[model samples]
Target: MSNGEMEERIIDHLRRNGKDTALKICKALAVSRSVANKHLYDLEKSKRVKKNDGTPPIWDLMETPDDPRPVLKTDTVEKVSEIVRTGGKTGLKAHEIARDHGLTRKTVNKHLHSLMDKGEVLKTDSNQWTSTGHQDSQASGDVTVSDSVLSKCFDIIGKLGKGAYGCVYKAQHKYDGKMYAVKKVKLTGDADAEVKALAKLEHTNIVRYITCWPSSQDWESCQDTSDQSDSSIVFKGSYTETSDYDSPGMESLSISTESESPAKPSQKHRKESVDPSNPSTTYLFIQMEFCERGTLTTWIRNEKKEQRTIIEIDQIFHEIVSGVEYIHSQNLIHRDLKPDNILFGAEGKVKIGDFGLAATLTNPNGAAIYRTKGRGTRSYMSPEQELHSNYGAKTDIFPLGLIWFEMLWELSTVSEKAYLWPDLRIQKCPEGFCVKYPTEHKFIIMMLSPTPHVRPCATTIKENLDRFFSMNHMLCQKTI
Candidate 1:
């Protein structure tokens, strides 16, 4: 059936059956649960139906008018403005306001844009709506810049990037007057892991961590507890140039599995718990050395355009291996290693940064360490890490393998890279390319080995690279 017909069926069933659960609607209509849940959320967003706060939320038709595009009431618009006002610097999305106020998202948006035209509200770069008169009280009592802390010690130049976890900004220190990257992230239970890792790590190849301080601020979060295809409960909310290094769009998101039992509170209760008007979040401000040259991902994009030489690529890869070797020496595993996490410092030095997923080895003296299911960007994650098995330093090698392939091969466009990532993961090489660089191909294949024990340590890899560079230099001299 068409979407409109499916939705109409859902509404009619709810109207006739009175209050019902999503599962019951699915069974009654002979539709799949995902389809049922999606349509239910759609109805909720449109203000046609509402769900009670219970595990496996019970659905019910709202008392809204039959007209799909009814004009929003004056009081409802006032509530929207108040929600934005209380949101302050942490603005709210129009759909969030619509769900809270029992109005259609389109209706709420219409009024929000109207409010924007009247200078009563403003739309942020993030596309969130906020009141024009609202000002951050800086509840942390420290100097504030663009709604985040650390203006007292550093001059906020501009925002470098933002992620789902927090934001990174470019700042200049008051005393040193040197520019640095400051990452502002929400403080969660294990938030200290990243700070601790960065503090302990000191190397030429790694990003330098200056200092950090804790601060509190009212931050906005959007929670989606919708049922997903994976049968896991997802809580989506909006970490660090400290690119939103987590993803292409610069948004950082964490997906954790939750039980699918009714013992959990209903979605209605969860929604009610969130006060749309006054949401606050605690944060950590991390100060680190600023690399004016940007990330390796950026470097690759530029290289793709200008076509940098293999020798240059080799030098860069050598520096990256140097950084990874140092990280292993410190008994820390950088679970997330990719082009984005590798940054370029002044003079084009390679700096390994973003220790967000880095973990300390339980047995520092041992070669391998076991960790819980490793969580990092998908394409770079090792097979063992992705499988939630007992992985060690070799896990880091897996991503390094992918990075090596990306650095050396000329994939022209992003679409090409995306198309080849899967094949590359299995150690497949481009046509004739492997024959040209037989030794490099063999080394890459070793790193991409499925078995953790089969892969070499970062130290061993670095030694090989050093030897390769030495031989290559001799060969160049011979050619001359």
Candidate 2:
């Protein structure tokens, strides 16, 4: 086939499928990869197609006008619908879709920006776009969760614990017969924002998302009916300033009193409470395999009483490194890599649980993205991470060292010995409590090399663990 014919076919493919990869285009068109790319460039230059989002730049076809010489509509609503349907809820850029469609990238990008300006398509994260209408609709249902979705998999049994995000419930899937810890985040503040961020990640060490349910009108109606039934009982008492009274307004008054009181409010306020009505907006529901052993913080504290052996410490360290390695492999920097975020699953399998502050290494749209402020636990943050400077995988190593130090020293010598260490004069570990390993001192130095460059990479640490384990095995054989 001629070059023009091949290009036309490519455009057709992209238009029909919504998106296409370079390899798929090349194979289907029976053209060389370079040749296919050149055709795509030409088409994109002509505004025939565009990329889906800032993500990997997958290509899609631009909708054409029916008139022989039609003027472009460039309506934001049309662009958003195209993005949502083609982008599969995970919106891509127009340029990316165009490239896949064998169209000029420049032309596609122009339309994308136009749509963004119209507020039809919103830029999510670095370069991704999603329908603004969709996001708004999702946000509106901030209270009620869907029973249809919830009923399929699991039934919540009891409360496990609570944290800054929401309550943890022990739930069991009816069909799979699997037990999972379901975290319900109420849609208040930036709960939905956090959930969107969390949804981007797909890693073994990270917690998995089951689904989200936005509050619906049906749920609101049910709640209203239920409230009316209880209203009579709730308001059947005389009022007094000091004494508790039953009144419809009494509950509201009590809420105000609690807010004004000198005494601290209930732990519910202090901790994160997931909103019930709008699971998607008010709360984010994340379901993952239950870790019966609890968090690394609790485990380490309890192990101190048991007087854990060096072998136990080594094993824990190894597991921690493995989980970190997985995170790095996915090009994700888990800024909050502390004992609190680490959990022990069945058979003491360590997994990283949170990604609220995690940052992707590369922009999904192939653009440079920057965050100004530092995030994650302050005590464990690397110097560069704390400064909010450009960072890579090495950014995570500093905290790994601190966790290792905590594991080795436990509660006893950690505080006193940490204070005795010489100041490193480094900006990252300013307290100078960080130390190198295998030193001659009775107290091993904490691994707090303030300089990110000096810190060991995840791969290097993994290799060291392998060597250590190998040597330990050899020693055991000799002793036997």
Number of the predicted model whose TM-score against the real structure is largest:
1
lDDT (0 to 1) per candidate: 0.68, 0.53
Q: Which digits, one per residue and each the tens of the lDDT, describe model 2 over residues 1-480?
A: 566656756764564344677777887656788888888888888777677565556787765553233233454335434745467568775546654555444345556554543335665633565766644555555344554344345554434544443445555687887767665544432344445645765655555555555433221111244433432112111112111111111101000011222221122222222335444443345565666555676666667735865567777777778877877776677666777667766677776775545666677775433432345555556676655435677778877776776666545554553453223213233232335234211122224565667666787777877888667657767877
lDDT of 2 at 236: 14
Residues forming the 10-long window of minimal summed lDDT in candidate 1: 247-256
Steric clash pairs (candidate 1): 53-266, 53-268, 53-269, 54-266, 164-252, 165-239, 166-239
lDDT by residue (tens digit), candidate 1, 1-480: 678668866765664356788887897778999999999999899787898889978998775666554568865676666778887678887657766766765567657755653346776645578775522333343433344346455655445555666667566687887878777765532346788988999899998999887655422212234422333322221232122234212222111224544122222322112123434334667788887666777666657734766678889999899989998888788888877677778888988887877777655466433343536777778887775435678889998988888877777865797788888888887887698778889899999998889999998998988899888878877887
How many angstroms is residue 379 displaced in model 2 relative to the true structure, after the best TM-score fit? 1.6
TM-score, cand. 1: 0.58
Error of 2 at 123 (Å): 6.8
